[model samples]
Target: MPHDLNRLFPLRPARVHEVCGPSAMSFAAIASARAQGDFLWIREGWQPDTLNPVALSEMADPARLLIARTANQIESLAVAEEALRDGAIPLVVIEVTRPLDLREGRRLQLAAKNGQTTGLCLIPEGMGSNAAETRWHAAPLFDPGGADSTLMRWEIIKNKTGTLGFWDVRWNAAAHRLDVVSPAGE
Candidate 1:
């Protein structure tokens, strides 16, 4: 039987959570998912020397998680591709400093379709592209904790699968999870 993409995917309740930096929300989104047990993480060859040890430890624990780390962007993408092929990971998140062209985006989309995975590209703020199923522009929310705080508000710029609008989403840095706040019902 052919896989049912629609059944597996839903726009209404937005299963996929994303958090972008000033450049790409990939890291934030991945970090949040890692905290939530969506998929195992593998950081490729781009480990920063100044990474927070505490944060790293929390994200790497295998008992409450299935996250792993690689060494670079290429390796990370490869691992994600393999996971999709094996049906181990249904969602793959990638961060791109530069905006992807239609061809490249189409290729990634096709790959996701074939592997039955969702490819999420984190682009820089104000970076416009017509390739993704949805385009979101996110910004950090006000936090009393200080600059290191992870609270954020996601602005949904464009969503092809559902209504073209935005929603208020909060990321609890303590819980490392996202919660969508509902508007006041009529």
Candidate 2:
């Protein structure tokens, strides 16, 4: 059976979703790369790590990426909310170092709904407490026997639809997107 990403993951538009774990950034990148057209990615200025253009090119068109760096977490959230409310971008991704409170999460939810845009929040592992449409936990899957180290394990920790599952996925360079290698039995 074909593992349709949209059907398997089902990231609803006009809602904010959460991605947490060691490879949360990668997982968020994969989602953005799969989306059509350009996207906005917001990060804190304090974050020393920068998004690699070449690396992003593997799954997404780096030239279409628009990045915004905020001076701090508060600024980052503000920018994200504004971008999300603008309804111009199809996808808005925000990397947050701290957990989002209930009020903050509600604000994002309203913004996304108003703009009809999808928001992806990259959070630290085990630090999610938001009203997200779905919450995903991603981690690198070690496969010493395999040559590729990009393999990842993903689990749906929370879903509004009440669907929960896990899968082993990897970036298909040839396909220019993520592919589910196998739907691990829950």
Candidate 3:
């Protein structure tokens, strides 16, 4: 994790974490950018939302991304699990459209731990009662045209390590990193 992210969200290595809400992908991308080395990203093949290379390049080298497009949710999970288990990549992010069952979550968790890699699941809706190390909900704080367009809020809804809180943050485009505006309800 990057120094700035470590301060707000200290993620444990060799564990699976979840990111929920509409901005989940963006949040995941930002975190992945901070992470070192090449990474694998698994997403549904039919999903309309495509990642923009230009936007991604602002945070990190876009060429370092290894993308895997799957036919369905099941395939996505399978690919993610296999990638995590391989332990070659430093980070693995999967776009999950459905909630993961306990067994599925646990499998991913174990794979991550065994491989000594970090896994981030982008869940459209929050995953419930799973083996994830932490669950974060991310949302934009304002519209793009607004004065605080870059502002966003990330809430740590669940954590196995006992840390819980939310922070108002903004992306510093020039700095290519997240800047904490305020620690909400700390």
Model 3 residue runs over 4 Å out of place are 1-10, 143-148, 183-186
Relative to the true structure, candidate 3 has a C-alpha RMSD (angstroms) of 3.6
What TM-score would every model get versus the actual structure? 0.58, 0.90, 0.88
RMSD of each: 7.5, 2.6, 3.6
Point out where model 1 deviates above 4 Å. Answer: 1-53, 56-83, 143-150, 172-177, 181-186
Highest lDDT model number: 2
Instruction: Give the winner by TM-score: 1 or 3.
Output: 3
TM-score, candidate 3, is 0.88
1-186: candidate 1 lDDT, tens digit per residue: 122223322322212223345523424443435433354444544545323445544333334334446665556556655654554465555555455566655655556666665555555565545656666666655555457545554455665655544444454556755445542244
Ranking by TM-score: 2, 3, 1
What residue pairs are clashing in model 3? none
Candidate 3 C-alpha lDDT tens digits along 78-183: 9988989998998999888888899999999999988999999988674553788889999887634457356788888888876677777777778887877754
Model 3 poorest ten-residue lDDT run? 1-10
